[model samples]
Target: MLSQSELLQFSRHIILPEIDIQGQEAIKSSHVLIIGLGGLGSPAAMYLAAAGVGEMTVVDNDLVETSNLQRQIIHQTNTVGKSKTESARAAIESLSPYTKVNTISEKASREVLGQFNSSNLTLALDCTDNFESRFLINEWSVANQIPLVSATAVAFSGQLAVFNRKQEDACYHCLYSNMDLPEGDCTDQGILSPVVGTMGSLQATEALKLILELEQPNGSFLLKYESLKTTFQKFKVPKDPNCSVCS
Candidate 1:
């Protein structure tokens, strides 16, 4: 039940046909796991907080660097030396004080990260840069039966996907079956500030869709955005029949 202040705060969402009062309530009842506090996590967490998601567990091992200010919009210039999880938690709290935020400031080990399965976790946002972390998060999501919204950005290109452990869908592990793929971070390849922001914000949108049970978007859909070309493309990620993790 939304109070007067909350109803006023989310009036815009409640008026939309797709997300009226019932949908807004669903959003308020959700618990989301955000697996990184970098570029994608920045906008995703902020938007989720603004949208009134009930709870969030932000996981990050890195500290904010002066160089991260460009795209990690959740952190301020003053938070440069702070842990990413703390920086993000503070930013989310400021946006929506009623939104409970939990911080995991160390490496996202399987034991530590998977512990959140004890809660009523609704979904996971995989904002990590490396495949290893993504795979680990995917494992947790599959094991817990939680849907996952994953995204990545580098230079002018970014990609997003919403995956679930459904018969027709490919999990993140199915997309990267080899596990030996080379990785590139924003430090080496570089990213346009808005490119990452765009993808991260979309992660928040997709999470909302799932939370509210809107249209039931296929879990295998893959969306690509190119800031340089100003184009968006969609594709289907076929599930690997022999996927080691989700098969």
Candidate 2:
């Protein structure tokens, strides 16, 4: 039930024909687990919180570094030495007090995920920079039948895709054959500040769309964005039965 204050707070969202009170209520009830708090996770977390997700479990093992401030918007200069989870929690609280945030200062692993992986988990967002973490997150999402909104931003390129086990959609592993990725992450190759931010905002939009049950005519597709070219190309990802993770 939305309070009088919440009703006024989300009036713009409620007024939308697609996301009326029912959709807003669904957003309020959804619990999303976000892994990684770097460039992509930063905007995704803030947008989701402002959009009114009932609960968010933030997982990140790294500490906020001075270098991260350029891309990781959730962490500030005062929090440079603090844990990413704590910094993110503090930031989200300042923006949306009603939304509950659970901070996990641990690496993305089955042990950490087991504690929060439950019936209430609406979805999992892969904001990780490396392929290893993304694959692990995908495996967990597939095993638990949870939808995964995965995004990657490196250099001037970004990719966004939604994977659902219940929908028999292609899992994240299906997109990659070799787990070994050379020159992986923004650390190796440089990434533009807004390029990653743009992807993160889009990632949040996809999560809300899933919660609202928006129409996706493109059954199972991956969106690739090249900032330099200012072009977006969509490709279909077919599930591979031989894939180790989902199979």
Candidate 3:
């Protein structure tokens, strides 16, 4: 049950038949783990925390750089030289003090992935730009039988997908077959600010949907967008028969 203040704070959601007080409670009880604090992670964290997701754990070792101001909108000029996780935490704290923001001021690796337990985490979001962290999150998601949402944006395009271990859908490795692509960071290849914002917001929406249990969206669905238009396409993301990790 919501207090008068909570009911009023979430009146818009309470009015929705799909998200009544009960659903809002679900949101208030869910715990989300977000990897990376750059482009995709920024908006995703902002919206989820503001929407009252009970807890958020953000991991990132990098520090805020002046160049990051373009697409990494979470950091301010004064926040430069600060750890990305710290900067992100301050933003979440201000927007939704109700939501607990756990800051991992270090980069996420296979070693640190154990910090997230199945019991502790309700969902995981991969907003990391690199392939290694992305694969690590996917492997951990499968091993722990947790759901993972991942989004990527470079240049003018972006892709979003949900990997559900409970349902045994295609993990991130299965979709791309393997992570053998050339390394490219936003520093080298510029990304449009709006593109990052759009994809990150969608990631938050999918995370909320999973937390609320409103509907099990197609895990295989992919939203590919460019500057001109956006399209949601559904197709099979089959599990790799010879997958080393999640087979």
Candidate 4:
């Protein structure tokens, strides 16, 4: 039940027809796992906390660098030497005291993933920059039948997708399995700050909808954002019968 203070704090959300009191309650009860606390994870975690997700487990091993301030909005100038997980937890707490945040100041290791309480974890958000982290999160989500929201941004472009193991959705491996693509890093390639912010916000939106079951979980989609052209393209992705991860 929402307390009087919570009701007032989330009055805008409660009044929305799509997200009424029941949905607000659902949001209040949901727990989310956020992997990575850099460019993409920053806004995703911030918005999720602001939206009143009951609990969030944030994982990241990196410390804040001076370069991160350009896009990693969750961490401030003073937190440059601090752990990303701790900085993110502080930011989320500042945004919503009602939202509980668990900080894991380590890489998303098997041990870390193993500790997640499956029953309490409503969704996992993949905000990591590399393919390996994304793949691991996808594998974990598929194995546990948990929903996953994955987003990436580099060089003025970004992509967002949601993979639900319970539904006939395309897993990340299904889409890029045979494709040979060079690994790109934000530091090496240079990324527009807002590009990641845009993708992160969309990730948060998709995670919330998936948690509430607000949208039909049909096939998945890969949404591409081109900042140069100011165009958004969405391509439908089907689950591959031969997908080694989700098959």
User: How close is every model to the real structure, measured as TM-score?
Assistant: 0.95, 0.95, 0.93, 0.97
- Greater lDDT among 3 and 4 belongs to 4
The per-candidate count of clashes, in order, stands at 0, 0, 0, 0
lDDT of 3: 0.85
- Estimate the overall C-alpha local distance difference test score of candidate 4: 0.89
Candidate 1 on 154-179: residue-level lDDT in tens?
A: 99999998896576678888887865
Kindly report which residue stretches of model 4 are placed more than 4 angstroms away from their true locations once superposed: none
Candidate 4: worst-modelled 10 consecutive residues by lDDT: 161-170
Q: For candidate 4, lDDT tens digit of each residue in 109-197? A: 77888776568688899998788877887888888888888998999999998776665778989988878965777889999999999
Better of 1 and 3 by lDDT: 1
Model 2 lDDT at residue 7: 94
lDDT of 2 by residue, 109-148 (tens): 8898777554869988999877778877888887788888
Query: Which whole-number lDDT from 0 to 100 does residue 197 have in model 1?
Result: 96
The number of the candidate with the highest TM-score is 4
TM-score, candidate number 1: 0.95
Alpha-carbon lDDT of model 2: 0.88
TM-score of 4: 0.97
Model 4 pairs in collision = none
